[model samples]
Target: MEENLSGQLADAVAQGADEADLARARAGDEAAFTRLVEPLRRELHAHCYRMLGSAHDADDALQDALLRAWRGLARFEGRSAVRTWLYTVATRTSLDIVEARGRRALPADLGPSSDRAVLDGNAPLTDVAWLAPYPDAGLAGDPAGPDARYEQREAVELAFVAALQHLPGNQRAALLLFEVLGFSAAEIATMMATSTTSVNSALARARKIVAHRVPPRTQQRTLRRIGDARVREIATRFATSLERGDADALVALLTEDVTWSMPPLPNWYRGIEAVTDFAVQVPMTRCPSWRHRVTSANGQPTVAFYLGDDAAGPHAAWSITVLTLRGEHIAEITSFLGPDGFAPFGLPASLP
Candidate 1:
């Protein structure tokens, strides 16, 4: 529907001036509506993701926001920039979704770190609100706005998103609007239908929790410091080591306090010894075959792996592992094990 309307909006633009397009859009021209919102789509979607912590949830919230914006377009009095108004709608919609469901979480949030690997792992918890990975493809990486605190990529990093989930819905919305998207406290208060004092208080509380949780340097900054070629080299080395079941090679890539966690399976291992022991027992000794392709997730390196045997034919989809780096060393490995992560990468069900 947006595509069809966008095409019509293009035709309308070809016919006249900017004023004409605005008139058409206000008069319910779907094409004009599309044109008005298209420029803001990516940022708005990102806002929803920050508020909700799941790309899937962000999609739903964004769609609802657009719909509401369309219906309310006639009431738009030109008091604020269209972008600001749209964000207001998107933020409110995300808050609604948060109320209905809840914030998503990582496995580490569920319980203490396992000293040893839980051999069979645990069953996939359907009811557990697990944090979903974001696909970085097609993102423009543009800054949110002039006053935005975080770059587009920085806002989506795994650590940042996970920390956001820890805040309450209102505080989360307030912080994103003020710090991430660059809205002023007074402006955000208007958007949320509250006082500036309340918005400021929310921002302060949200920042405290996030500051406590997130690492000092963002993944974006670290990736830039390392450069792209070195980033790929590190990810490729880890994948190759895993495929060959080379425990030593794998350990060589890890930091002394490296951590590995496979969500939906509550157990996670911390430190070099625990991680290496888990790797040797499970992925190295038990899994007969492995294949991998390097990918990106949350502005950091990721590896999508397949596991099976030669005789059984093609390998089956396994995990989408995202590595967290502390300089050149692999600090954390979040292998999102399940078919759920496979689809986002467009991976085949089996590899022959």
Candidate 2:
């Protein structure tokens, strides 16, 4: 099978590959090139996603970077490891994309959070560049490198990626390369065409901004502290409460300061009182039937919900709600409303 071949090739590369395949790849052998870079594709795509805040943008950036690498592979002397060189190319490519398009944002960034849920959800903001959810299924389980400050799962948490968008492009790249990808200052300077001191300065500023925006601990660490079974129990209980229209049960699981937001809808709520009111009025009362399957997204517990009544046919895909926990309680709920999110998680389009 293809997977077996890829595993064999990765093993071969790990044991020490010769210059033969590199030469073939440089000479325009597509299969040879595929073999050479296959091991790194997942992580490279993740890096692009982190930089751009959208999976679609990451796909384009990664494709462009790979094409550039193929064309320039011949010029690659024995200066650096292939992984580092590819990352340098990918990082610069992402920077170029950032220079043109700028950062992505959520509804919260557009304006202040509404104290009460807007009963009539605003028109979907098609024009705004919003952050997209990442399907955690495809993540590379290993850290980018040994020196990475964050674990692989820790780096891709929703809050971390959202906070990253607040930083400028150069600062973003510097911080990612240093803290996430584990590139040393000297190496990152070479990639960014800047001095080590400049890289350090950028990293310091980026870190300060990120620290204030992101929580003190990462979701991955919190999940580890809670254990998988407890996290699943919370997700299942929340989903069941919605299905039964049990507002009290839902409120019991949420923190006093729990926040809820639905993107594209531009309506959000903070605190248990506001969230409960929104949940009862909109989700529970409006939608008559509910079905949910537990899933994970952006390194957090999530539910893929379907809503409909017998008169309307099968239950249709509704939203993918990602939960942010503060210890045992749900601290934040980002319910990304729209059926478009369903396919990525391999969820059913309709539940009978």
Candidate 3:
């Protein structure tokens, strides 16, 4: 990690890095540029995740931001710290993507559901793939310090990010800048090329909308405790069952009216039986000797699996599973195999 973070561009961001590093990069020093930006990889990735809702987009955007940052390094002019400038580039890039897609939310957003049991407010919008909750563990700092002051739970929670999506892209950017990143209104105004008043107005409206949509503290706490314990228990049991191919135990953890879907796979499965049939009789049957290792994803327990001895290398990443727990059972499971899906939740590249 140190070697990776200490390259040429690394010299650029170094405490007393010679101004010459930037000058050299400007003259086309790829090594210098890489060094300058490498240290920010994790933070930039997390920032992208917050803005884009999907780790995949975050990874892509982070890549784009780094590439763009390198290309534009000479022009950076120390207007802001390299970090802040990179953030501006990333946040804008993310909002552009959000605006282009008009943002995403689902049926759960349109109505309440059991998901509400885990949050402080209304049901999540199912149609919308809201921001996946980031693990508190993802955050590294005085967890209680002002640096981490954004409503940690609410900031990355699926429902809140979904509410944020409802706001215009600029408003979402403003809120993240002001509330999450602690940027001043004037700074945000400059970023969005708007007045302080516009930034303030957008934030006010965003907050009001968020308040109504987020769950109450009392409700959230109770549900969280119940949900947390249940989720961990279910994930542990679920993984054990899958390892043993215990069809009965596997079926038992699923809710009677559960739903399971594999994104990028088109069809959705409903209820325990359908899920059971699909898991056991279909894929599991084909890969009878498969193995799984537990990791975390989307703020939930996730299973990262591989088949045979050839599963450790590149492109071998299989399904990335996200669970929804209710009591001692899982109510829903989403198996995401998108290339970038394994990130953000901090699931490893391969199981040990």
- The TM-score values for the models, in the order shown, are 0.91, 0.92, 0.64
For TM-score, the strongest prediction is: 2
Give the RMSD in angstroms, all C-alphas superposed, for model 3: 8.6
The most accurate candidate by lDDT is: 2
Q: What is the lDDT of residue 36 in candidate 1?
A: 79
The digit string of per-residue lDDT tens for model 1 on 1-352 reads 9999999999687646545666788998999888878877877877787788777888899999999999998998878877788899999999999999988988889888877767874677778888877778625544566788888788888899999999999999998888888889999999999999999899899999999999999888888999999999999999989778899999999999999988777788999999999999988888888888889987889998888885356888888898899898899999888776777666776688
Point out where model 2 deviates above 4 Å: 1-15
Worst 10 residues of 3 by lDDT: 115-124
Better of 2 and 3 by lDDT: 2
Ranked by TM-score, top first: 2, 1, 3
Model 1 misplacement above 4 A: 1-19
Poorest stretch of ten by lDDT in candidate 1: 137-146
Give per-residue lDDT, candidate 1, residue 172: 92
Ranking by lDDT: 2, 1, 3
Of candidates 3 and 1, the better by TM-score: 1
The digit string of per-residue lDDT tens for model 2 on 134-199 reads 888758543577788987777778898999999999999999989998999999998889899999
RMSD (CA, Å), each prediction? 5.3, 4.0, 8.6
